[model samples]
Structure formats: C-alpha cells, structure tokens
Target: MSNFLPTLQQNSSNNFQGDENNLQKTIKPQRGFKWNSKQPQKQQHPAISSLNTPTHNNSSNSSNKDIIDFNYTPSHQLPYLNNRNFNNNSNVPKLAQVSSHKDLKKLVETTLNSDSVLEQAIKLPKGENINEWFAVHTVDFYNHINMLYGCVTEFCSYDTCPKMIATNEYEYLWNINGVPKSVSAPDYVKYLMQWCQKIFDNEKIFPTDSNVPFPSNFEKNYIKPMLKRLFRVYAHIYCHHFNEIYEMNLQVLLNTSFRHFCCFTKYFKLLSNDDYGPLLELVNELS
Candidate 1:
C-alpha cells in the first residue's frame, strides 16, 4: 500500500505541478484555483481577421451562410399604369373599333347610291321572278300580322286582363305553306303586355300644373286613339267609364291607335244593373 501511494503522488506532481523551467509546460492548481487575470481575447490573430472580412470564407461561418443574392420584383402594377401612354394622338382600341363600324356603314351606303348598283338592285326579274310589288306586299302582310299579334298578346298578358271571348280561341285561320296555323293564348297575352308597356310607360293621361298642357288637336288625333284602344281591350272597368261600354267594345274592331289593350269596370253600380239595354244599344249604333 505504501509503494502504491508514492507512485500515485509522483504522477499527480507531474500533471498538476509542471517544472518551472519549461516554458511550454503549464501547472494547473487543484479544485480551489482563482480566475486567470492575464489572459486577453485574440483580436489581432490572422484567423479572426479573416472572419471579419466580407469574403466567401467569412460568410461561410455566419447564420445567413446559404443566403444568395437576387434581384426581386413584384407581379402586378397599380391602376395608374392604364392611363400611361407615350403617344398623345393615339385613340383607345375601343374607340377605334367603333370608328371602323361607322366607316363601313358609310362605304356601304355610298356603294348602294352609285348608278350601276342602284339600277341593278331596282331592276325586276323576268318570267314570274321576284317583283317589286310582291316584295312590298309580302313585307306589308308580315308586318301587319306581327303588329296585330303583338297588340293582342301584350294586352292579354296582364295578370288582370280579361279572358278571351269564344271567337278568340287558338284555331286555324288558314294554312300557310302547308304549315298549320296556331297561336296559343299565352303567346297572345305576352304580345299584348309588351304593346301596353310601350304606350303607357311614358304617356301622361292628364297634364299637371307645372307642365304646359298638350294641344287639343294632338289629344283628338293621337291621345283619342290610344284611349280608345286601352278601353276596348283592358278587361277591368271601374266607376268612371263603364257607361261608355258600347263605344269601347266597338272601338276594339275599328281603332288601330292603341299600342296595347287593357280593360277595367267603370262603375260597380252600372256593372250590377240587370238592364244592359243601353249598353247594347250604344254598341249597335257604333257598329
């Protein structure tokens, strides 16, 4: 045990208490050592100086080591860019398109007005070919049919419009080009409503104080036809106009002034009366 203790002491002295003569050897105190006051941070060392440079080797050791340089850009521009134009006289694309349409219309009109084109277009075909009168008559017939259909349809479309009379049933008037003629009740109602809307939407029945009164002649010519048409067709009549049922019923067939038709009862008292003799007489007189 004594031999082992001397050997252990010799090893401790060599490690913890180095020879004072060797400059490279260090002697560290046992557990109760004080802090070293002579040591300084190596700020002037070449390794540290390299680390402070902005070179690649210095950046390699930093937290942002992998960050690469790039020129970033945004996706969209602000609305003001729409107003930016280099040429002052350059019109917008939409305006140019509209101008092109106007130019085309003028060119077509000019061409049609030329002597050869006008003469050729006006010339009639030979041997039962297309005649001027035939074209006119065909157009007139279709126009009349369309107008009549529109009038009736628009009037009958109103929720309050009266049911059609027995004569107004969807029956064949005539076969056209082998096609069966048919006009549904709903079709008639739709046309009637459209016609009525056109006429009454902006029409003033009676003038007001602020406005100049419409001329009496205008009323007699224009307004009278409209009023007659409306009275003849619109189904419901209230107190004021029920007395004129004869005039209204007869006017339905004679007048073409109404754009659309609708009717209303004029007076409850007259409507309830069992004696419709006066009304019948008025209708007969008109007819």
Candidate 2:
C-alpha cells in the first residue's frame, strides 16, 4: 500500500454524529421519492422495494437541474491517441483553455491510464501552478462521480436506501441549514453534488482568467470539503452499487476513477487521514 494509506482518525463526535453500528432496516414502508416505475426492477433489501428511474427529467437544458445534466466521456473510451487533448467539458475550467492547461489535463489523463499511479500521483509539471492542478482535477472528479451515480440512479432510490449510510458503521448525516439530518441516498447525493458544483462555478472560488491567482484559502476551504464529500459518494457507490456496477461492466471505470481520485487527493493532502476512514480498506486494496 502507498504510504498515504495509513488508517485515519475518526471524525470528532461534534463534527459528524452517527451511531457506528450496522445500518438498521426500518420497518416503515419506503415512503419518499421513487424512480421511474416503468424501468426494470432489481432484487433489493427487505422493506425497500426496488423503484423507478431518476427523479429529474433527462432533458437538453442543464439549468437548475438538481443533478447537473452534463455528461463526461472518459478519455480511455475515446480514440485517446487521436484525441488526447480535446476535453470539451465546459463545466470544468480549462485554466489552460487558451494555454497549457489542456496539456496538463492530457498529462494527468495519461497518468490515470498509466501503470505507475503512485509515482505519477505527486507529479506537478515543471513551473505549473499547483492551484490550477487542483482546480482541474477537482472538477473532473466531480463530473466523473456525478456521471457514475447517474448510471445507478435507477437503483439508488429514496425507498431502497432510506438513510445515507456507506454501511452500518459509517452513516452520513447531511447538515441541512444547521441540523444534521438523515436523508435519502439520492437526495443527499443530489444536494452534495449541487453544492460542489456551485462552488466550482464561482469565479471567486475558481477563477478562469490566467492573470488572476486562486485565493490562499483555496486548498483548505474549497478543495478539502469538496473532495471529502466526493469520497463519501464513492463510498456509497462501492458499498451499495458495486454489484450493479459489476453487472453493468462499469466496475473498471468506477475503480479507475476512484483510484485516480485517491491519487490526486492523497498526493495533495487535500483530505486528512480521518476523511479516508470510510473507504480505508478499499484504499488499501486499490492502492
């Protein structure tokens, strides 16, 4: 395992509150948001009937969409040799859109597809701005996990997953306004993705102009929170949707994206040891 895989400290009680026991299946019939009823159903946990399709309409307009509508096509799936530097995802800033950021993205993409992940994880191109490196990867990971969840939305319904727990041991309670509340898996993930997208969209937080420098607190304030929450989404997918992903033949995609995420976050130290706790075993395995 990489040196970064050391077991992390648990979250302080006040910061995150949850009973560290197995997720208890409630007897109440799943009563909230349901996916498309017409879609095929899958075997599910007791008391949670498998439900319908995604809640949001799949439309062309990508505005105020609870889950961002933008889609990401991984470079590996493309004719990478012919199109290595042609990233068209507008949601992520090409801090190098008119310059060298495209090259950086291609370099990172190559590293993701390369065998020596640990060695390449810490590399920053000579004379590259570390903030720009973090910015691009941050948005890319968001697009990736968001797209992956969209794939499993049919399975990850409010009724199926009543509470946002990776397992019985690690439950994620979202702090709505101020209070920590247990919400449905889809809703919690929706809120989480939207929040991260909002941050990523803010020019003040992530400037697109080359002359402007990112704020000093960018790493501590923005990168840390975005990635820590992103990891939770990854944890949920691994815990709840791995079988579905494997059946879909997207397991390699998920695992590769996750490993790339681990590489960037661990190398940059954006997330602390405690933040990796939920998926520590997977981190070790994937490492």
Candidate 3:
C-alpha cells in the first residue's frame, strides 16, 4: 500500500506539470513586440506638418491684402500714370464787362453835342437875339425879377443868399396872374412850373465852343438855379394863401421833388435830342 501511495504521488506531480504547460501555451504573448518599439509611423512629411501649422498666408491674407491696397495708392494722382504735368504758370483770358443802358447814355452825352438839325430848329426868331427873347418871354416880363426883390426883403437876413431858397420858391409860383391877393394857387403852381421850364431851356445852350467837352457843372450850377427858382415860387404860393387848389398843387410838387432833387433830373444823352430838351426834363422832375 505504501508503494501504491508513492506511485500515485508521482502521477499527481506529472499531472500538475502538464497543466502548467497547457496554461503557458494557451496564454502566449505576441512575437517581436517590445513596450518601446514602433516604426515611428514613417514620420509624416514636413509638407504635412506645414499644412497644419498656423500660416499668415491663409489665416490673415484677406485683411493684409486690404491694408496693402489702402496704403499703396495716392488719391490726388492722375489714375494710372505716375507723373502729372500741372500748368499753373499760364495766364487765363478775362471776359469783358458791359455798361448799363443809362450809363452808356451819360457817357455819350458827356463828350458829344446835338447834330445840325437841332440847332436850325431851335434858332431865335428873325431880328431877335436869343438871350433878349428868352428874358422877355420867359421871365414873366420881369415880374419874376420884381418878386426876386420881395424875396430878398423877406428872407435875406440869413447868412446865405435868400436867393438860394427864395429863387426856388419864386420860380415855382411866378406865372399866377391877377393881383397877388386874388390869384388862384393851382394856376400859380402851373405858372411857376412853366417859368422853371423856360429858364431851364434858356440856360442849357450847347456850349458855344463845340470842341470843348460839355462841362460837368452845367446841370448843377445852371439847371439847379432854375429848379431853385421854381422852389422859391412854391414857397411864396404856399405862404401867401392857403386853399384846396394850393394843397393839391403842393402835393403834386412834393411828389415830384425827388426828380428835381437829384442833380439835373434831365435826359442828358447827346445826338438824341436838342440840348434844351434836357432842361425841359429838369423842369418836369422839379415841378
């Protein structure tokens, strides 16, 4: 029984050894591998690394291109060409200016006189010198001159000649006929205006010296004297009597005063009318 026990023990040991061998075969490790072994994955090409890296060409290219375009061009330069030729040194032509119609008329009148037709038409009657006829017919036959004496008496106390204001008054009222007390004022106003027209016509003769330019002072000194005479007549007519006719005439006279107040109030253009025509215009403006 002891021998049998020994043999059984030996068989049990062999069985254990075979079981160990089977376990080794069933759980064997893969061949040719180590914990640190890899082919390094055939290192991917640098081109592939470059593609993954952040690059300005693709990431910021549109914005960078916009900046370059903004900074590259100058605004004022001629579009495609690099150089420009500016001609700042040349002189520009100037346009001529035109004179107004009224100014043109005055310019002509200042230098010229009426042609022959006016002179023949305005000649004095046979056997009458011009000045004598003008004085006798136009001055109310010295009645205006006589009134000048009264004007002197009434207003001559002031430093300046009463003739200044007084003559203007006298000329405005001279033609009213009948005794001064009874004379109607409208008739007086008309008389004065007509008298002024006559004096204006008499004084404005084309200067005897045709070659000489028309004097600038002719209207102021000569034409103004006539208007002032009329103004004096205006004053006297108003002063002596107050009436409805006088009031109406006074309003008319005042309304037209500006026409007279402006220097000559005449149409002074030459070659258009007789020199006397401007004097008549002066009377119209004043009266």
Candidate 4:
C-alpha cells in the first residue's frame, strides 16, 4: 500500500507539470517572462502587430509627417482660413484668376451678356405674385450690397470719410420726424447695414413659405424705403469712394450689381425718375 501511494503521488505531479507547460505554450509571451516586474505583463494581441509595423508608401509617410507636425496660427486680419491657390496646370475658371479691372469686366460681361441670363431676367416672377418677386429681389439686392460694403469696409473709416454726402453735394442729411441731421459716412453705412440685416432676419416679414401672407403695405413702405437707402449708398460710393473701389479693382462687380438693380427696379416701376437723378448718366453708361 505505501509503494502504491508513492506511484499515485508521482503520477499526479507529472499531470500537473504537463498542464502548466500547455498553458505557458498557449500564452507565448511576446517578450520572455521577467522576474523583476511584480505583475505579469500582457502579451500583445496579433491584431496590434500591423500597427507596430512601419508603412513604406510615400504618400502615407508624407501625410503621417504632416499630422505629427500640424500646428495652427490664428489670424486677426481675416476671419476664415485662406484657400489654396488654384494650380496653373489645372482647368480652373478664368474668373478664379481675376485680379484686375479688365479681368473683372470680362467675367462680368461673360456672365451678364449671356442671352439665357438676359431672357431669364426679363421673365422674372412670370406669375402675378409681386410679393414673392419683391422678396426675391430684395434678398438678392441685400446680398449684393452686403458684399460691396464688405469689400471697402476696411478702408471706409471716419477719419477718411467725414461726411456721408458726396464730394459735389453740400450736405447729405437724413431727416426723421421733421428733424434733418447730417451723419458721418461710416455711421450712415452702419445704419444701412443694420436696417437690411433687420429685414433679412425677420422671417415673419420675409417668410420662406410662399403661402404666408406678406405684411400689409410691405412693398410700399418697407421696400421703397430700402431701395431709396440702397440708391443713396450707391450714389455715395460712386461719388466719394470711386478711388477706393478702383484700388480694390471691384469696379466691374459694383457696376454690374448697380446695373442689375436698376433693371429690376425699372422693370417693376418701383423707383421714381427722381430717385435715379444723381446716377442717371452713370447708369446709362453701365447699361
């Protein structure tokens, strides 16, 4: 019985050692087991091996390098990131290369002189919905004026432009409630921008839904006043700030925008003859 017990113990010990060896083989530590570390290190999974391996593709290497060295610098001059210049080899539009008055004029003429555009313009608001037509044109004019104003805002300062009146006029005063007062050009521009912004922001007045009834006398009261103010802005720019416009090389854009506005207003009989008195010759020239 004592000899049988010894044999049984030896057999049990051999089985336990075999089990331990199988477990070690299954685990297969990436690095051999370390005695110094208190905790057993986890072996890296096979999936992670690809991530550890270096890539040889040139494009991938350049992209990785760019990612590693990426940094952002804030600019105070402009609000948005600059767009990359179009490649000379690429088939970019000629308008994309516009930097001079001649280039701008060519682009403007190419766009406005198109038979399709003129035909479309002539047939605007084909249906009898004047409110919708007015709303559409109002938004269009607002955007155009906003862009023109933005182009020269940096240069249009109180120091440079003391009065709102043109060089030829004695005084350009805005009257309200039987009170006539002259304001600085910058202040006048700010007021015009605010007025337009208010109209644009009011969805109730200029609802996107066609079914919504436009506010009563919106065209007579709101639109007329808006157009009058816009004309004054145009007049002021033409008379006092032509040099600034020229310097910015935005003459073609300004001219085209004004011509379109004049055509729209004339087609609808929105503006009286007197409203266009100041810019009559200039309008004729542009047309």
Top lDDT prediction, candidate number = 2
Query: How much does each candidate deviate from the true structure in C-alpha RMSD?
Result: 51.7, 14.3, 62.1, 35.2
How many pairs of residues in model 2 come into backbone collision?
Answer: 6
lDDT of each: 0.24, 0.56, 0.25, 0.48
Best by TM-score: 2
Judge candidate 3 against the unseen true structure and give its global Cα lDDT, from 0 to 1: 0.25
Which lDDT tens digits does candidate 2 get at residues 129-224? 787667666766776887777777888898889877776667777777566777888877877765665565455666645556789988877777
Q: Judged by lDDT against the true structure, how good is candidate 2?
A: 0.56
TM-score of each: 0.19, 0.63, 0.21, 0.58
Say which prediction, candidate 1 or candidate 3, comes out ahead on lDDT: 3
lDDT string, candidate 3, 44-148, tens digits = 111111211111113332221111000101111111111112233132222222254334333333321223422332334465333322322222312332232
> How many residue pairs collide in each prediction?
23, 6, 15, 0
Model 1 TM-score relative to the real fold: 0.19
Output the better candidate (2/3) by TM-score.
2
TM-score of 2: 0.63
lDDT: worst 10-residue window of model 1: 6-15
Which ranking of candidates, highest lDDT first? 2, 4, 3, 1
